[model samples]
Target chain A: MKRVIFGSSWLPYAFLAPQILIVIIFFYLPAAEAVRASFYLENPFGGGSTFVGIDNYKDVLTDDNYVRVAKFTFWFSLLVTFFSLAIALLLAVKADTVLRGAKSYRILLMWVYAIAPPVAGLIGVLMFDQHVGPITDVAALFGYKMQIGVNYNDTAAAMIIISIWKQVPVNFIFFLSGLQSIPKAVREAAQIDCRSSWRRFWTVTFPMLAPTGFFLLIINITYALFDTFAVIDVVMKNEPGSNPMTLVYKVYLDGFRGSDLGGSSAQSVILMALVLLLTIFQFRMIERRVHYT
Target chain B: MMETTSSNLEVEARAGGRRTPLLSQRRFWRSVGDHTVLWLGVLFMLAPVLLAFLTSTHDAVTIHRDGLQFLPGDHFGETYEAVLFGATGFTGKATGLVMTFNSMVLGIGFAVGKIVISMMAAYAIVYFRIPFATLAFWVIFTTLLLPLEVRILPSYEIVQKMGLLNSYTGLILPLIASATGTFFFRQFFKSVPDELLEAARIDGAGPFKFFVDILVPMSKTMIAAIFIIMFVFGWNQYLWPTLITTDEGYYTLVRGIKQIIQVWVGANIPEYGQAMALAILAMLPPILVVVVFQRWFIKGLTESDK
Candidate 1:
């Protein structure tokens, strides 16, 4: 993109070799491997795999357990994406309005962004631990004995809550930055046009933040899908016995513990397609949003 | 003129007095509401950390007997000492200190390696009119579509076949294969002024000399920001490190979490305090980095989204 540039034959390639080499070995080779293995039934034992065209896909698609995991992943991503964005929007709006000590609030709120998903999940497990958790005690007060990792719904609830908690800081950071970027003149004009602050926000500010919202939506969905792998792993304690898990976890479980390489590869290919679609959708939206600005 | 202005202001003030107090009251309530919501959000973020840190200070038996602790217990010194200095995993090589060292290796190594390699590739792309440059960019760009999670199994297989298991290079290199760093540096390099390059060429500076003397110095802040972001990302990586490092000696703190859980599950009265301690240790560095370098951290994060 630079106007003035160096024109060299071999020097540029020399510089790019390390990166290209790593990408070939890691990204492209493994991606091709996933596609190739999806067509074969890899023997769990050391014996060689037999080529079974489309059979692995069929088994994974028809399996009741895989269906359940897929359904959970769908709903899990939806809930986390929705709630985190909403909570973050509210906090960002509030933080933007408050005049004093906004810096302190931001540092407090966004520090959690640094905590890894599994570490957050570990803390979640402790808080929801049936024997000694404060949350379990509170739930008992309401006569609802919260049994995380034992009851299916309770485990899902813990996963969703912790995932949201881990996610809000990033969303807050984006939303807060988005809110601050709104032009001062626009806010003043809206203030004159509408007397009520609530109505003014809906009319003026929300539309202005659409680009940020769309970007964050895609990000939140991706976070729920992939980043939560460790969170689910820690919460489920590596035991997926009827416990809810995202699609990524299912891939890990089937590949590593189940040792059903073909089936896992098929599921992984399915995930790859889903991510591709989401990314394409995101790019289109981004292009459109760019046009508006 | 001054008296007329003063009388006009006095009249306006007297007329608007009742309306002003009501508006002020509304604002007062609004401020209260805002502070209340923010405080609650802060507490939501703070409670888990506070509880985790507090629980770590107690003895394991106390934490086991009573769920988790709210206040510091008497075994603070002894517990941390044991977890830090004690070599006590099944493999007996996973001390807190060693895992921390491995985490530093992953974090610092990942940041440095990513920056160096990405700068080179980005420099080649942005500064040179090389053949197939666009094609190279696209190949790297498409990687953003398929995450490491999707290709994780096969990646593990390739790494295993290549005998990279339990090696730091295995843990770090595959992750740097992404185009994120290259994309970042390319955009940054494109933004550098053409006059600088023109001036350098006029001074007869070669490409490598110009890069080292001029571009690198100009990109100090950018490099620092990227380093912080990449360090946190590498330190927090769970899946790849989990898969690649089968040896306890190679375990980073983030991946050491699984070993901790396994030990807890096997133990009679799980080491709740030590588990919390390890979890806190895993979180401490990243949190400190983000909090301390708040501006640079936020800048790198939000800008990269674009």
Candidate 2:
């Protein structure tokens, strides 16, 4: 009995054993392999890989299409973050203070957000498929001949809209929590001081909501850059000018579609560098501004 | 005391019948602006689902004639029938029992596996004073930074090597553990009081009993939170499943929906009304879950704010 009790020091390891094993097998091991594959021109389906050094990285940088995609991705992330946060903040303030049936309204919002992005992507495709888009109808009402379809022609704008719509609920939830976290006394005190509503929000409420905003920015950008391609693939299929098409899709096309794993591995490496640089900046730069209190 | 009375008077002034200065009138106007903005935001957020609902009720002929509007057009049943039975002139079997079961198997299996592993790891980290505990915790947590898409290549290779592709386990395995769940559970277990465990130990309770009896009960809310999250994540998964399973028999609902919609789009033009009806149906289960467990979901988000 004593031996069993003492021997139980390994219980944490035992409890943790399954999770550690899975993470190693699934995430870490794969991530390490991805990095290694980035360096080599790999053809696993065919046989093995050849060492290509930094050629993949070089191709990703020097290529005009890669440069254009990188540019589009940056702008798309920035614009989506801006619009989604702005609209969400507006809703949060209204919901916190004056909206009736806020609970029901929020659930409605959450439901939309929780719908899988792929399904939402399909909805976007249905709504915007050139001949069928309701938004195109609206555009026509304004005497514009613009199409709302999910082709390569408008994928950049389509991606931005898709990202914004999908993320609005998440941003709204964040802002709602931020609004609730503020003490009512602070608003009352501002009222007593004869502060205007705009002044009060700019000075007090906005500052309090900063951390939530910061967190949303990081989460939103990462999701926009990484998780969006699958939705794009589903909706757009093999659109010609889809922005920031990762090495994943590029690899998918090269190996499966083109049967050239070498080029795909190189593309994947380039994609890794682009993502790593952004992630490091987020951790190193923006995280410092997050006010924990 | 003065502040309290003054605030009470303010409430009274606002509530009770009285006329105030133009300053108050301006404030009222500002609030009107706020309300307009808020209502518009709500309208925008709810617009897609509302559009889906409206479009689904109308036939292709109405949408073709009058455009997408919320007004009913008396073809809701017909559109659903067509979508379910491929009457809108699309190919392949209409999505029914087989697809839903496949989705359920994938979602429940992955969610259960993720939560169990997360809870055990969380319990171990908090209770046992293990070597490299902090390092393990941080390393696992940091993996959340890399999106699943970033690691798709390696994951595919691993799945291929294990010969799990096209199997239910293959559909679920790559997603069975989540770094976010560990982070949530670790935070939760850290809050469990040491005294409770001390009491259990003095009574000659073993670690397993102590965990089962004391710790699990204490962290029910956190577990519920993780469970809902993992369940939703697994249920909604698309790309990884699409990548691993090329077989239609193994397709989850989302993958199946994509396949059906792609075929619909590839034809001359999409059957907008029927497609919208299909999208609405796909959204129903998760929406029901949201309505049923909203309180837990909101509480989980707020609690984790700490």
Best by DockQ: 1
Query: In candidate 2, which residue pairs clash?
Result: none
By summed lDDT, the worst window of 10 consecutive residues in model 1 chain B runs over: B1-10
Tens-digit lDDT track for model 1 on A90-121? Answer: 89998898766678889989999999898998
- Give per-residue CA lDDT, model 1, range B1-306, as digits (tens): 235434544454455566777765666667667777888888898999999999999977788888889998887787787778897442377899998999999999999999999899999989998788888888887887888999999999899999899999899999998988888988899889999999999999989888899999999888888888999999999999999988888988899887776666657888788888888889999999999999999988887662
DockQ of each model vs. true complex: 0.62, 0.44
Which regions in candidate 2 have their CA more than 4 angstroms from the true location?
A1-7, A43-45, A148-153, A241-256, A270-292, B1-17, B21-24, B61-69, B81-91, B302-306
Candidate 1: segments with Cα more than 4 A from true spot: B1-19, B88-91
Predicted model with the maximum TM-score: 1
Candidate 2 TM-score on chain B: 0.85
